[model samples]
Target chain A: MEIKTLSQDGVTIVTPVGRVDTSTAKAFEDGVMASISACNKIAIRFDEIDYMSSAGLRVVLMAGKKLSAIKGELVLINMPEKIFSVFKTSGFDKIIKICQTFEESKQFFN
Target chain B: MATAANILVLDDDEDTADLFRQKFRHQIMDGIYKFSFVIHPEEALDLLQQQVFDIFISDINVAGTDGISFIAKLRKDYSFMRSIVISAYGDINTLRAVMRGGAHDFVIKPIDFKDFGDTLAKTVRVVEQLRQAEATSRKLSAISDELGVSAQLQRSILPSNSLKKGNIEIWADSIPAAEVGGDFYDFFWLNNAKLGIVMADVSGKNVSAAMFALIAKTLIKSFSQIYTSPARCFETVNRTLYNENATSMFVTAIYGIVDMEKNELTYTNAGHLPIAAIRHNEDPRFLECEAGMALGICEDIVFTDSVHTFSPGEMILLYTDGVPEATDKNGNEYDYERFSEVLRQNAIMSPNLLTRALMESIREFTKGMSQSDDITTLCLKYRLRVTPNVN
Candidate 1:
């Protein structure tokens, strides 16, 4: 998976591409967790992701709990509908704010 | 006593042969053992090739040949025969060289005839035991290979269908701790809009458990197609398995049916781990289900189904005890507290990553420790379309 970190408007955006399964989940967790520690507000852009297993969901959960511990903010932006349903059904959408576009996620920072 | 063995002795001193004959005269007279002596290394080699001697005794300092080299050559050609080396040089280097040359043991020359018979007896017993152990090890390796092949076949039974149905994304995985394991997970579409998911753990390991797992999995899938509720599906499957469970083995399972059109999940637990639900914006929490008897334990036990409506963007997670019960080198279990904490931490990730992340946490906690059970996780994300559709 490709994780590109973009720091714009005080938010670190982690965009990972490809399928995140058992083999690559650790790297994905490290990338997002590192971004979470460095910045107060982090946004994971899911534009390039097409498939994610429970392993990937685990990284998100860990990042969410960490951000919560630090009173930091984490937002998921531009998640595909298929991916969004995964977040919604698992109750992740409630804990981590998700938006359809960067504009919508920008509102969380405001 | 009947003659028990034949011993070949290779010594350069011609008088040594007569010394052995006198020393073991009682044993020879009793027909307990027979001894033969060769004055030259070449003569010993020629005799060894022609006759099968039960044991070989060689003197290290022969007139024209080194005992160590002769033993090494004997090992190269007749390795199955055990040998003992005797030398006047009692130094550690000579002892090590003899051993490296494949001598089963070493003896000092100017041979104490009194101790010689006792030493030879012990060596023969040890060699017999070694032969038995090697044979057992070969048989064990063959059984292990067969188990490996069966494990591969078990993995092949997992559903290969694309996990996506409408907006629901389902993913499941199982990892065995042994050559074969009792844990199994599967997901199948009951109909166009209904999905069936199963995660089960049998009570034991190896081929017996794997065979039962196959039977349980097949029965569950077949009964699920005919039964309407998760409780009824498990009830019928349980009766079928209980009648055939002569070994008294049992299986803990969690079976769920997802109504995709209505975004509802109906599930039942058979003495399995509690299911977890992660709601958007809220921390992940374990869902409580009615405590029912595990399958194959009783024929008349009743199971109850719990229903939970999927609020858009909610996830349902099911796993075997291998997750919470994973232990560290210190023997402390990973436990539900750590599992919940891990789930809360990785709550924002996708389904695949979520499961993968839990496995990573378990792996980290249990580093260097051997797992005793199979680890398995099944996750379903319910996402109905924005536009309404009929069920």
Candidate 2:
């Protein structure tokens, strides 16, 4: 897995590529938590991510809970339909914010 | 600062072996780098036989048993040793042979000194990372085993033998999808007049959900002692869960209180699936008890109660979503239609047999496929009263 972070105006955009499974879930969690100390508005770009399992969902749920406690926002953008299905079935779509495009995610800032 | 571990270099060329030793020495003075140069492969084997080493680097074209053979022989006994082969003539076939012979890596002719050093460092780092991961997985497996035992203990907390409290005959079964499930069911007597029935499904699966289910059960039991009304019991549980839950996970539950003498059953549903009530010799119908959201999602949520009269031989069946949502191999759900049919077929059987037949039918429908969610079922059958003569 590859993770890159870009920060602007106190918002951090995290682009993750490749599959996130049990083997790499911890690294993904660490990368997301590292951004938590500095940025309140976080956006995750999952366009390149091909797959995710329950272990991956656990990490995202953990980050969501952390951000919610601080009254911050964690937005997911451009998720692949296959990966998005898992979230929707798990009811995470109701609890977390998801945007169809990066432009739509920027609306939260406005 | 921790010192890098010692590495052993075995090469036929004395000059090349010395260069390899000097390169690692310059990287860290505190770290010890060891070199053993042998003109033939036999001498290298002798050295390896005498002592243990963190790594072994060799030339593929060494005389008297080439590097590929040496690696194959060494791996038979010293399986844990990390081996790397360096070759002046970078033969793709030779590289593949050495790798298949258990060599960790291969360096080509005119080795870029910088790349060689970095590769060596990375090889060690990768090995250490693998070791740590193995250790962690072992710990997690042990903890999971312990949790499985605790889950069995939790199942034992349910009433094993039915309490002949009034005219209600209650039977419940909980089956976890994995080693531990988040589904729970319990029925306990509040007093001579009332009996409380609780069924809950916590979000997520495994240990997190199992822990929350236990806590929810405890809170409901403790609070129901003070307030016997079904609505009040759920209100107290929701408030307590909202304050105590740190993960923000929620639970769907139904709490019912049966007044045996008055033949009244009142219940509050908190985002749980609707319960089914089958009248004596009549078809099953879903109870009209829908009001509240899932618990632990918000504070000050209101839950309304629904009351119904329980006739003799009538039955009420409560279950987690796992039953209705169970899917077959083709992704078709078992659903409420099949569930009610199973109830109607086995409605005449004893409560225990009814639950067993329902589960058997689900198993048959799925064709022995693995259950994806926890399955929980609770049934209450009201019996007719026998007249007594007053002396």
Candidate 3:
């Protein structure tokens, strides 16, 4: 997995590409958690992400709960159709905010 | 921030080439795009040969030859290059031909700059993804290569071939359940008249288990040089291993010293399987020695010493649980009862032949079942007299 971060208007967008399985889950989790101490709003961009397994989901849930405890927002944006389906099937769509576009993601902070 | 796309444009028309170059010049200056231009297919090929490009854009109706043929030749040489065909007049047949010739995308004449830019960006992303996958695959291959070398090293620790010392003929065989296993066996002359034999099984399989097995085997040999008693040898080995090991791993072993001059065998069993002894023209029986706990478990544990009298033409066999617990296609174990029966039947053969026959029987029993653990066995046949023996 490759993780890249970008910040716009104080909201940090983390983009992770490639499969997130058992071998790469720790790196993904570390990347997400590392941003939590500094950023108030964390946006995970899944526009180019291909697939994610249970291990990846566990990290997302952990980051979500951690950010929530700090009274911060954990936003998921531009999820590709394949991964959006996984999110929906896993019931994560119900608990996490899903934005279809970057504009919508930016609006959530405003 | 948007990363610039490094685009290579190949077109024969000077006006079209300049226009293509000018269109990206502003973006290039703004750090959103980078461009390279070539006027001919050969020039494009030469540029590709010189340096790698993120994307290749070529005119379909170039002078001298068509873009389809160029793509075909390019695909033959560099299948990894991402190529796109541009034409003023789009032909369905030509489009199909260029696509079949390995063009990544087709653009109609009077290119819509927005669509073109998007296609170029997507192409660059595809190329980057491919490069990343290749790098990861190479790294994985390197790790696999290292694992193979470790497995080879593990194999080297086993006895090379069968050998005879004095009146005792020793033969051993080991088969790992995977690329590497935890089972090991070794034999060396303890003295001019005493030969030492050892067989052990580590708790797990693969590299970690093989490493521990090597450590245990080394400790046994090193300790045996100072302690003549089998129990004392195991005690020293256990203490050393217990201090060195951080993980909660253990090993079961059988160590014995065979005195060929007196025809006596003294051994200690460290939570290992029972040893079988068959005397000439007598029924085979388990050695029934007092067993001790596995090594590297607790430092205070003690191993008991056991002695047995060996007569001429007698045989002793030591093995790991992998042998008796081996299951067949029917899920039936080749248990101790069947193993003893096979050993008794093959008792008349030489130690080497008997070990081979035992392995053959196991292979037959587990016809379709994959070996689930490491199988190791050591045999020592005592020949009383040094005279010419009948085969």
| Candidate number achieving the greatest TM-score relative to the actual structure | 3
TM-score of candidate 2 on Cα atoms, chains taken together: 0.54
True contacts kept of each: 0.00, 0.00, 0.00
Better of 1 and 3 by lDDT: 3
Candidate 2 per-residue C-alpha lDDT over B80-146 given as tens digits, one digit per residue, 9 for 90 to 100: 5677788888688878988998888889978888988877777676555655777899999999999
Candidate 2 local lDDT, A2-51, one digit each (tens) = 88899866779987777675456778888898987688789988898766
Sort by lDDT, best first: what order? 3, 1, 2
Query: In candidate 3, which residue ranges exceed 4 Å CA deviation?
Result: A1-110, B1-4, B26-32, B139-184, B187-195, B201-214, B225-232, B238-252, B257-274, B287-314, B320-339, B349-376, B381-391
Model 1: residues with Cα > 4 Å off, grouped in runs:
A1-110, B1-152, B388-391
Better of 1 and 2 by TM-score: 2
The residue-by-residue lDDT of candidate 1 on B1-391, one tens digit each, is 1246678998878898898888888888887677889988778878888887768898877724476777887877875568888878788897797799888887897788767788888776765666668789999999999988866676676666238668888778777878677788888889998888888877666588788888999999999989989999999999999899876566778899989887888999876767899877787878877757678766787889998888876778888767876768875778778888877776667778778888999999999987766798887777757985679
Against the hidden reference, what TM-scores do the models get? 0.48, 0.54, 0.56
Q: What's the best-to-worst order under DockQ?
A: 2, 1, 3
Looking at model 2, give its docking quality level. incorrect
Assess each model's interface with DockQ, reporting 2 decimals per model: 0.01, 0.04, 0.01
DockQ of 1: 0.01
DockQ of 3: 0.01
lDDT of 1 at B276: 92
